[model samples]
Target: MNTVTRPRILVVGAGFAGVECVRRLERKLSPDEADVTLVTPFAYQLYLPLLPQVASGVLTPQSIAVSLRRSKKYRTRIIPGGAIGVDLKSKVCVIRTITDQIVDEPYDYIVLAPGSITRTFDIPGLTDHAFGMKTLAEAAYIRDHVIAQLDLADASQDPVERASRLQFVVVGGGYAGTETAACLQRLTHAAVKRYPRLDPSLIKWHLIDIAPKLMPELGEKLGSSAQEILRRRGIEISLGTSIAKAGPEEVTFTDGRVIPTRTLIWTAGVVASPLIATLGAETVKGRLAVAPEMNLPGEDGVFALGDSAAVPDLAKGDGAMCPPTAQHALRQGRHVADNVIASLRAQTMKPYVHKDLGLVVDLGGTDAVSKPLGIELRGLPAQAVARGYHWSALRTNVAKTRVMTNWLLNAVAGDDFVRTGFQARKAARLKDFEYTDAYLTPEQVRARVEGARAPE
Candidate 1:
């Protein structure tokens, strides 16, 4: 007598979409229904919206990293690796494990939610000198680097060295760039009190974007409101401007101005993960193009979502694709899980549909702007809504407790302005955080699946 093998369902990320999809799958599917496997380098689902808080020392790194193994309901075999490539025709995924081991994983159903990487231009010294705010390691390292700058500036006898260390430049005016500059600026503002030798007046932060307006999606009124708040806090806002070149000690702007600074934090934007290119599939603006049901056209049992996929926005009807936001990714995750279940049961799959739920910008402290459900709010009210929404979105009780405790502790006692000193010897650049060149070529992927050893 022959026993039937359970169908394998592979999820290729631990981000908001992938984690939510895995959780929903585990909760709804029986133990014998299918074998679930999650492929990711880390075991935690990073709450990216609150990353600036982590970098600012308002929250610990573990507070935002919701562990995948914490759930008792989890039956998915977790693979501590990243899926570098996927072959749709052969239904195989090539993975590079954390220990430098290569493996091939075959699956009956595949969910491509590999997310995105920080987008960078060909500007000189960008890949070498710029720090990113995308990963947990980067955030932690940035905190140390920021604190180190303060320490160095305080001890420096040369006015030029001190001035260069005191100034900081942040690129991009979108939510990530704005919030990162705001939170880190607040960090320096509070930390300056601890350094007796450093002059608080010397500290400066410049926020620049190529776009004419800052966070244009927030509407003119709220956008201006946000600008006013930042300007009031002494953050220099330069719109319709971007970096022409980046140097180790300074950055040149497109508007023919050069600013001397030791730190350049790039939160400009993101493009889909490089893994999407291995499939040789159609893409819209660097994101994989998927059907409204979140499945790749003409490929059964293959699905995609999150930042890697250009999922059509059914609600917005004019050939529009959903924006790469956590809100849409979270919803799309659950919807895609339901569709996966339907596919297994031979039922019809429904299209993913969600309306714009408005935007929130946490500028650290009581300065926040939010338009939840079309209601525009600013100051204390907006701050409350923003924090509440983020706090409630956490997945587990353990995570929620840790985050709340951290928030309370921060509110009551404040930060110590100390650096961990781990990043002093580490490489903390855009290329270091995002391994954009790690994915295998399409031909190599096919060879790997066919039992041939491909070139390293």
Candidate 2:
């Protein structure tokens, strides 16, 4: 009797980890040996680090998102869907396709890299009044919304409404929040020139965070310099503070200060996708707990990486977990791929380790800050390095070229300031993106009511 080995690997979420894993696995395993399938909600990989640039018109949205098929030359199949649930015991994953159809697929091995979703706070009116910057859709919506607001402010006859429309508030001093404020401020400054009726001074930019310092991870010197640049550009920086309440017209701060603003961008933080909770596995800080090799303990043939996995940072000397950033995710993806191939061949797997390689921040235009190696840099040189680094880091040549072209055009001319007009009306609900069971279909509701009335 002859034994045939069946090997099919399912990779959830085509972000940094899943994409790298599939690309490497394709190289390591021959076409006859195994099949690789990559699952994601979208067809492209979003370069999140430079998303603020996209929102501020520094780069078009297409520049940051590289299509999966365009980048990979291997035979990996791309499955367009979001994994809703995973039964670790059965090695089956329940996925919800874009059209809302549900399907369960089984795999010989699985790599969980579902990534994360925006972490919302319980502050009053936040869900109704705040905008999140987690997805490409959200970023695009913000870009349109900001430009639209400028238009509205210039056109409005009422002074109060005009003031509200012009004022922008962002909560979170972390990299995402700070970069967003910087980028949007630059956008409005350039855009207001087109609207002579509106003063750039009327367009207020406020950045608030509960932390004592901005970009604390960037160290004191660089963070302070970044904050100073933003302040000089008329951006109001409020540290050790947060919003207590947010209304349609204004936001009240915890410190009893109130600001009239229609825009409240939230980049406070992110947590692992809800799919992790459905896996029935131990998780640390909402992430699936995994060994340094990115394998789930006690779960055979199952692995996890990227933001969804709590990978220990051995390079830190201490046992702290790796921070969720593109820097770590890129490296983790490669390590996980090698480990997976090693596992398939019954070989020893190496541990994942990486040190902080400094940070780069583009403050839109010629203002930027960075600390490549151990030396701190700022101003035009920093801006050059920052943009250059992002350009080089792009996964595909198409994305790289598109981004470069956008920059060149912007430099020669200026922002078109043309709104895509997607979010003329607000999308205030999470269910708008991912429908929940609480929202039953008409058929489901009727069936449920009928089943209730029919004797048990």
Candidate 3:
């Protein structure tokens, strides 16, 4: 008797797109149909939007981290590693595990949704002296660092040191930077009362962006409102400006102004993961280019989506690619899963299409701005919409409960402002978290895959 081998489906990333795709595939595909494998550095799908709250001590790190192994029905093999390279010709991916072990994984069907990393420019000292808000570790480290700064400021006798320690700089006026600045400002503002020696007036938050407007996607009126709200809270909003150079003690702005500070949070933007380059495929603005159905044009059984893929914006048309947002990524993930199943069954695949559901900006406490379903809202109403949307989007009941409990606890009991001290002696930088140089070259990927298959 002859036995048939099952088709292997490999998904790279455990982010919004990858997790959604895997879940959908697992639910739809029969056990005998295919073997599904997930490649990821961590075991959780991080709820990235709430990372600011995590950094501000409003929510615990585990609350936003939705575990991947929670599904009892899941049969997918989870590889505790990151895909560093993909050899499209050989249908193999080169992965670097958490223990620094290298392995080559082959697949018949591949979904490239490895997401993105912090995008940095040619600016000097950026990789060395900046803090990022992308990952859970980064958020936790930032919280500890921020609290330590306050502790140092309170204990110091030198006025200059105190002043520098009190000042914080955040670049990028988009959702991440804006929310980070707002939430952390609130943390410091509330915590300063405990430190009677430190003057509240000395705590300054400078929010600068190279773009002319703050959160330009929020439109003029809403953007103006956000800017006004932040400015009212004493946050110095500087438009059309960015950091020219970063130092251990100060940062020099592009507009030729130098500010003394220890904290420099860089949330400017993100670029496609370095893994995308290994395939040597066509890309639009560093993102892997895919068809309307989320598949590579000539590559059989190969798909790409989320931040790594330049998926066409069918809703907006006019040759526009979808913006790298959680909304689009989540939808694209589900849509691509359907396409993958369709291909397997030799059925017609549908193109990905979805209208915008509007945007939400949580500025900590009751301050928020949201345009849910095109209905503009602000203050308490906006805050309600923002939190409601986030709570509903959580994948698990446990995640929702934890997040809700955290919100209630924070509102009633408030924060303790204690430093975890995990990142005390370590220097956390852009290069540290985002190992951009860890990816293998296309030639190296091909060699590794072929070498593994060769007889010893």
User: For each candidate, C-alpha RMSD in Å?
Assistant: 1.8, 4.6, 0.9
lDDT pick, better of 2 and 3? 3
For model 1, the stretches where C-alpha displacement exceeds 4 angstroms are 453-456
Q: Who is ahead in TM-score, 2 or 3? A: 3
Cα lDDT of all candidates, in order? 0.93, 0.84, 0.94
Model 2 C-alpha lDDT versus the unseen true structure: 0.84
| Candidate 3 global TM-score | 0.99
- For candidate 3, what is the total of clashing residue pairs? 0
TM-score of each: 0.98, 0.93, 0.99
Among all candidates shown, the one with the greatest lDDT: 3
Candidate with maximal TM-score: 3
The TM-score obtained by model 1 is 0.98
In model 3, residue pairs whose N, Cα or C atoms come closer than 3 Å (at least 3 residues apart or on different chains), thus clashing, are none
- Tens-digit lDDT track for model 1 on 294-412? 99999989999999999999899999999999999999999999999999889999999999888999998889999999899999999999989999999889889998999889888
Ranking by TM-score: 3, 1, 2
Off by over 4 Å in 3: none
Quote the positional error of residue 236 for candidate 3 in Å. Answer: 0.3
Q: Candidate order by lDDT, highest to lowest?
A: 3, 1, 2
Candidate 3 lDDT by residue in tens digits, 171-289: 99999999999999999999999999999999999999999999998888888889989999999999999999999989999999999999999999999999999999999999999
